[model samples]
Target chain A: MSQPIDKQRRAFLATASGAAAATAVAPGVFLHAVAEAAPRDSAVSDSVRYGMLIDTSKCAEGCTDCVSACDRENGLDMLLKPEGASDQHWDMQRPRWIRQVKLKNNLTGRVTALPMMCQHCEHPPCVDVCPTGASFRRADGIVMVDRHTCIGCRYCMMACPYNARSFIHESVRLKPTATPRGKGCVESCNFCVHRLDNGGTTTACQDACQHGAIVFGDLRDPNSAVSKALAQYPSEQIRADLKLNTGVRYTDI
Target chain B: MSKIHYREWGIESPRYWGLLAVLAAIVALGGFATLYMEHEGHWVTGMTNQVVWGTPHVFAIFLIVAASGALNVASIGSVFGQKMYKPLARLSGLMAITLLVGGLIVLVLDLGQPARLIVAMTTYNFKSIFAWNIYLYVGFLAIVAVYLFTMMERKANRYSHGVGVLAFVWRLILTTGTGSIFGFIVARQGYDAAIMAPMFIIMSFAYGMALYLLVLMFTFNTDERPLGDMVVRRLKNLLGVFVAAIFYFTLVYHLTNLYGTENHAYEAFILRDGGVYTWVFWLGWVLLGMVVPMGILFHPALGAQRGAITIAALLVVLGGLSAIYVIVIGGQAFPMSMFPGYTVIESGYYDGVDGMARAYSPSLPEFLLGLGGIALALLATFVAVRLLQFLPTSLADEVVDPHLAK
Candidate 1:
């Protein structure tokens, strides 16, 4: 019985090896888009500083498409409000990865609308203040919190200038596989890191924006869309005096 | 001069047991509160993303600051060579250890992941002031423990001054590190200033001295040990100076912020129109915590009376808590100036609303948890006094005052 089973396994192995060998020689010919589907096995490179440029001129007020898309993509929408929790409290308590902000110029009285999220600063105060170093900026310039190490001290929340980060105030029953969230950890927008890691070119928010107000690309590459927009338009970093050298920039505010 | 004699708190009275039981019950309640908050997450309480830290921080920070301050007697006795303070040094050292332990317990338990405290201890982010504080806190405990031993053990008495000096320096650094936790956040208008470090140090001194006097008086009076007018006068006078220093720093801190055009809005919010925060600052911190207590301490008529001094000390402790509440909660209450020149009219997060001061009312559990910390500190001080010779047999004028004894 053992000999027969071993012989069957050998035959199966030969067939599997034959298919693998054929696919390797002509990759996508045998296995449809095999190389395209293959995950990035190497460390993320620092050569590309991923960034975004939001054109407030193009951003329409009352349009929450970017926020909705982010919620859907990150599974923030999946969280059920705890029973008996008030809507007012739930609004404040729920973790929001992106929020639509409508700002009126104090002097000009002109209104401007845009989506706000983590600026992903060069010198992130959150990272500097986090006792466990759970808050960190990726090599590719996407700032994120490592939930595994996050003690949920909330010093990062206090330190954030943009109010970009959110704490999981309640137990998370449901979350996306890509964005693993739980109670007792700080979290923020990571430029849709899962999408980027999976070889996707654009984020959920960038893709969802019909007006093309949000542009996501490598800021390090001058020819890239974000860099080109930054060069073309007079974009400014929010609180430019902070000198955070933020990866996210805005224009026509 | 007569040799100082130390003894355990051997009252064996029912009142003593009652006090311990009450503290124990509160500690148990605090434990329950922590479990409830931890199980339900912070949402069950009033804490939201907007106000991540709530009452627990107020208690923890107050206790920790007071812990550093509690060592004043020992430092005065050993380091500053105040012979009058030498008799009270042992209790001072003990109170410091207990208060810190109690405060740290509340702080660790309040964490989003209390079980992950090991990670906090093991992980080191040197640049982070919080990471440095773990060392400062732990080192404070160790250094104070050694200092206690030098004072307690007969042969080690010779090294008491050396260890006392080390403990004194470590505590100053400890308090500084604690202040730096808030001060280092450069963007927050309330805490960005470097004055916070020195301000906290001065605060610790006042808060610490108040607690020290209260404990010393209570313990001595209960046990029928005479705490002299000389010791009382010295400590109370020291407390007055500290309270006045706090006043000076408060003035300077506010004035500095007021001078800066950028900080005008924040200053206004804190000083005039921050609603509850403003009330807590002026009424709780300034009026009751400082002015009234200072009046009681410095008034020639009231200053000599033990009951009046006790009341003043209690006021100082209460005021210290108010000051900490304002610093921790009120500081976070003010919204971050995300759009410096633009008013955020609408946002999913409550930005630029309610005079830009976010709502934060301390819930029942949070309040209970904070009270539990104070009880724990007192309970430990009680137990340690009973079990060990932490108090002098007597602190009569002739016993304590070198001039009189001679």
Candidate 2:
């Protein structure tokens, strides 16, 4: 099985240059075109596809307006209410669309406010490994958890490359009204599926950016700010060694 | 109605109904708590983030592993003639099935969405160890059930010996799979070996034998035959072997971890550094779970003496229970960091037994519910016994005596 896969790689590479010139067929004759076109670029176009770029240098620390925008738009506060006798619905942790990650760089003696969430990898391990097909990646690259069918096994918890998933160990009703209620099963970053589906320009993080430090765009368009930023500036994704082909990008400044 | 009397397996009337009532009340308490939690959520239980999986998952996995060993005796002895274990075979099989069910109940109550458990089988992450474990656990129980059914089917009831043989072989593989669930987790310091599966198998045999002896003792309290002196000796011998195997498993598990480089492993070292779980690991698990029990059985006075063996059996049961607590809690208490110089993040009491950041002491309700699962197992077994006569009514000496089989 490993041998055949290697041979296919060899054959695919042999035809790469020939296929590049024949592009008018579009969505076309070669698989490598599909690979390159599956952009990590920052370009947000008129197309339906969406992406995020995190700027670590000017984290605009202490400002939680993005979190507030998310909480308000997503009805997240409702999920944290204490379990009441009358309430039948359990509060989901409403996987964080954006989170503040404070990373301490030992050598530099600097603490950076890196608001981290899901990287939303191109070769998402979560989706590939889900036996029951509960984890999936859409054609446009948003990863989703079908909460309706989740079995609460928390296997994805162990498999996650990022400690991104959280198990809802308790009922939402029993939490403080602001408890960010979640129960049973598991969840993590969903990239604001509700907002993206409605053709919103960017997520709460992008809208909340006072410094315009955050960017959202389509890599396919090649003209978006994210694309231009990546082209000119040098930055990196966390754990680049992992090779997830993640859609999320970051710039130091 | 006069109580029916028989003498084949040392049969005589005994009043076990009082034991039955106390057990029933505990079962009801457990069931009541579980029902409350289900209606509410796991919030009704004492578990929290740091201690996300507490007593329920701990005991559930322990019992499941123990049951695999218990079932092994029947599979090995009854079908394959591992004569060293033949005499204890029937009781081991019965105890194995009951314990597996008991373990399953503990896990179900621990779920945030207990009702959603069926979805695990329905929608599995084929790549996740957690998903595979659920499947292995279920599959093991199913094989055990068939093995038991066939054992009881007799000449008049239909079935072949081949299925029983398959069950026996499958059980060895099943135990190995269970061990691997913990062993393969390179990230978790506590479980990293091929040995845990076999270790778990040995543990089950020990637990099952302990349970069988206790049950048999109760069954034969008034009988003239005394369940046979020879049968007692045979079981004690097996108990000794299991203890040695368990001891070997413990040593190898630790030695491998000492050499391997993982954060969970470095954390495991903390277990011996006079931490909350250190004493529990050393005295409770090493001395008590393995050494003392083994010591009692190795002595001739304890080994040959009927009363001594019973006391020995009780100690073994307690030791097994302590082993489960130490292994599970020790594994969890490990700080998330995997490196030495980086220092593990210590939170609340939940991470350790003291210092109180994320401390968790299973509440009265949680403890009661935990004990209730055992009570439920006993009551279930008892009611079944009254209705089913699961113990044979007519072994040559009525309670299995190799001496009398001569």
**TM-score for all predictions?**
0.94, 0.76
What DockQ does model 1 achieve?
A: 0.69
Per-residue lDDT over B236-334 for candidate 1, one digit per residue giving the tens place of the 0 to 100 score: 999999999999999999998899899999999899989998999999899999999999999999999999999999999999999999999998888
Over the stretch A70-100, how does candidate 1's per-residue lDDT look in tens digits? 9999999998888877888878889998998
Q: State the displacement of the C-alpha of residue B47, model 1, in Å, after optimal TM-score superposition.
A: 1.2
Flag regions of model 1 displaced more than 4 Å.
A1-39
DockQ by candidate, in order: 0.69, 0.14
**Could you tell me the TM-score of candidate 2?**
0.76
Report the error of model 1 at residue A87, Å.
1.6
- B1-406: candidate 2 lDDT, tens digit per residue: 1121232333333445766778988878888877776665555555544345667666677667667766655766667765434434455666677777887788777666667767766776666555676776677677666766665556622442466677667666666765666655443445545677777777777776676777666665634333556556666787878878878877777766667675333444545453656777777677876787788888877677777778777777777777776666555445333222222122111122221223345555666667777777677666565655455433334334334444
| lDDT score for residue B210 of model 2 | 75
Chain B TM-score (each prediction, in order): 0.98, 0.84
Model 2 C-alpha lDDT per residue in residues A45-149, reported as the tens digit of each score: 335445677777867666666666665655554455454522222222233445554444435545556565567777776665454666767666677677666
Give the interface-residue alpha carbon RMSD of model 2. Answer: 6.1
- Indicate the DockQ of the complex predicted as candidate 2: 0.14
Instruction: State residue B301's C-alpha deviation in candidate 1, in Å.
Output: 1.5
